[model samples]
Target chain A: MTEDKKSVCKPTVFEELYKKHSKDVFNFMFYKTGSKANAEDLLQEAFVKLWKNCEKVAYEKAKSFLFTVSSNLFLNEKKHEKVVHKYIENQNKSSYKDNDTPENVLRQKEFQDKLNNAIASLSEKQREVFLMSRIDKKKYAEIAETLGISVKAVEKRMHNALVILRDKIGKI
Target chain B: MKTEDNIENKDIFLAKWIAGEISDSELKKLVSEEDFNVFQEIKNQSEHLSVPNFDTDKNFSAIKQKLETPKKKSKVIPLWMYAAAASVVIMISFFLFKTSSTVIQTSFGEQRIVMLADSSEVILNAKSKLTYQPELWKFERKLKLEGEGYFKVKKGSTFTVETENGSVTVLGTQFDVNTSDDFFKVVCYEGKVSVKQQNKEVILTQSDAYQNIQNEITTWNSKNEAPTWINGEISFEKTPLKIVFESLEKQFDISIENKTSSNKLFTGTLSNTNLELALQTLTSAMQLKYTISGKNITITE
Candidate 1:
């Protein structure tokens, strides 16, 4: 029954899609831009775009459209100015650094700093693939579809990302 | 050996493992491999990398608001046409305002307190939503409810609460109404309340609990000021296992998959604060085994 009804995108269907996929899209944006506010804004823009073009997009393709739109929006914003520094600044100001033992807090701060630096050193494409795989938990094929690349390419990028991260965070 | 072939194979296994899709034999094979410790360490470190919690409700509401706002235009029209457009706009806005209602909703493992226009207090239970029109409060004090709520209506007009299965009407009373997929219950704590279900009307005064299970109406006595859910515990009496588990899901925000045919009736009490203890209490009483992974729980006999 749902298969037959998949052709026409009703408001209720759109809402269900939103409720199901919005978290994944938001996490994707969060990984792209390490700012919660920016991620939230991009998520809204992406879903609003999908809502406006719902007639053209099938229920099956909405997730890819959302990811593509959100990633493009992040890239466009990056083209205007460098936002990585701001991301790091916001990371330092995050609430994760509180209410722990002094030694443990210091260790956590050092670990977080090193991890962010390691992620920052990766190539843009590798970073995107890695984050989509690890953070968003997207399938390789889905990531490939969203980025308009082959599944093999996604695998290669993910492998490169892991190699770099392993080398950077050595012996941990 | 950490050769390219081994690394590639390990990466494939690691991906499958992280996705929780790896078979047991494949997992054993991966664990037996030489560079398995390296992959394990990387996975552990990667899991510690934190992402900020995204407030889905807040962002979704923002998107809905943006969708509601009309796009701007920069065209100029004649004065007469402008007057006609203004009247049309006024009419549309008026109708929109008339139909607009205030909604109070609570997600799983959450509860909320809502004060209506007439100062009637309503305590919404977990996984519930209550919608009412403030504009029509004076003439028609009515509310539409889903899930469960405890209402304390101030004495004035006839206040009514409507659900999918039935409707409850009262002049001034304190009562509890629960409307789920397969259950409809109304428990009157104070004053007189009338419940109408499928052309059958049942009126109760105090300490009366009316339940309709599979279209079978049952009445009992509950001598309490409010429902047991308000006291941080949920007490059930001869309820089906499925309904009890559904309530547990709502109270804990967990997905429960019942693998066995649990046709047994359970009469037990569980605390909402401690999840592990609650699960222990429930599963032990039902003589079932359960496993929990993250927020998902699967129960079996």
Candidate 2:
């Protein structure tokens, strides 16, 4: 049944793969670099590369293939210059409707910034796995499958990331 | 919290807690009450934290455009570059034959204002070359422009600026003429100016703009009384990214290797003084990204 499926080279099939995987892949890159602009650049490069090599990449393997390609691209970029990891926060103020006092809002914003810095301070490996699990809500097994790592490794990274973040953020 | 359990077991337990596999009472049993609250808050806010929203459709179109843009001919010069070089060479050789002509050229990031013998003023933009014969100027006001120049011609019989693409003639008025390979633009600020390109002739009055991009003629009303470049700002109105990159290259004296085939149009203004701010302005607006290594820059989407 898998062999009878359409080739990934077909525009329709390739586009389907893009729509399905591009967002996650972009988030994956964003989590790694902590910069949306860099992530967008790397995302475009990975998809274009996938299109160029569609003959070899099957539809089922496209997501992992993109992840691997983008990861490698990010690494190569890192070798040339120190990648600045500034996570620009877009204010999602409406989500916290519990108390709308001015002081409470300022305190929340301060806490958010500190939390962002703590996350950015984590090791690249720990940060990616942790964000993939917490932010993207991916399972350990799914994250393992995409990163080509074992589930045990994913769990270890996630746990370490939490411990480090908790220590850095301290109280609240 | 058991002493007999190893680190791996704790890893699995925390992972399960994060995945919501463990009940809150059970999680509290593993950690202090304060720890439980912090852990719960971390989990909740981390989920709430959002990165920039990635537009799938827009990026897919950008990717499709990149894939379609021809990449095999990396060694060959692009058509616009070829046209620009040829036009400059032709303009230079035409001047080389004139022994009594005066030529004024501005290097990269340099602009110059020259007062003609006829008391007319000409402001040359960066990387521009202007040539005129003083002897012939008394009989007929004619000059050649290799790049971009704004002319304030003295009221006379006919003042002409010859370019590779076409010629602009004015009788004592202010106007700007810009020419490159397959691109010609004439903006009139005051008085009447007649633009001739191939077989097409257009007359532009005050606040009139005429542009021919690959034989496609478009005319629009001007907004400003003078070119903004004189004020140290480069402005574009629905201009292609290619032209924007070229202008940046000329202004910053840098070579930009554009790696994408994105035909996105941009309408904005950029400062000529600061390269970093200019690149940020252009890339962020175009929804693209760039990396600068040494003097070379690469733009991608």
All candidates: interface RMSD? 5.0, 2.0
- B14-88, model 2: which lDDT tens digit per residue? 777888776777777878887787777777678777778898888887786565432542121222221111001
TM-score, every prediction:
0.47, 0.52
- Against the native complex, each candidate's DockQ, computed on alpha carbons, is 0.20, 0.34
Off by over 4 Å in 1: A1-172, B1-99
lDDT of 1: 0.70
- In TM-score terms, which candidate is top? 2
Candidate 2, residue B215: Cα displacement in angstroms equals 21
lDDT of 2: 0.76
lDDT tens digits by residue: candidate 1, B2-62:
3554566665544555445555445556464434544555554555555677787888887
Tell me the lDDT of model 1 at B91.
Answer: 3
Cα lDDT for residue A43, candidate 2:
95
| Cα lDDT tens digits for candidate 1, A1-172 | 3475464247678778888888888777776676777888899998888877878987788888888888888888773244462233424334344677788767656755665688777877887777777656678988888788987777777777766765676653
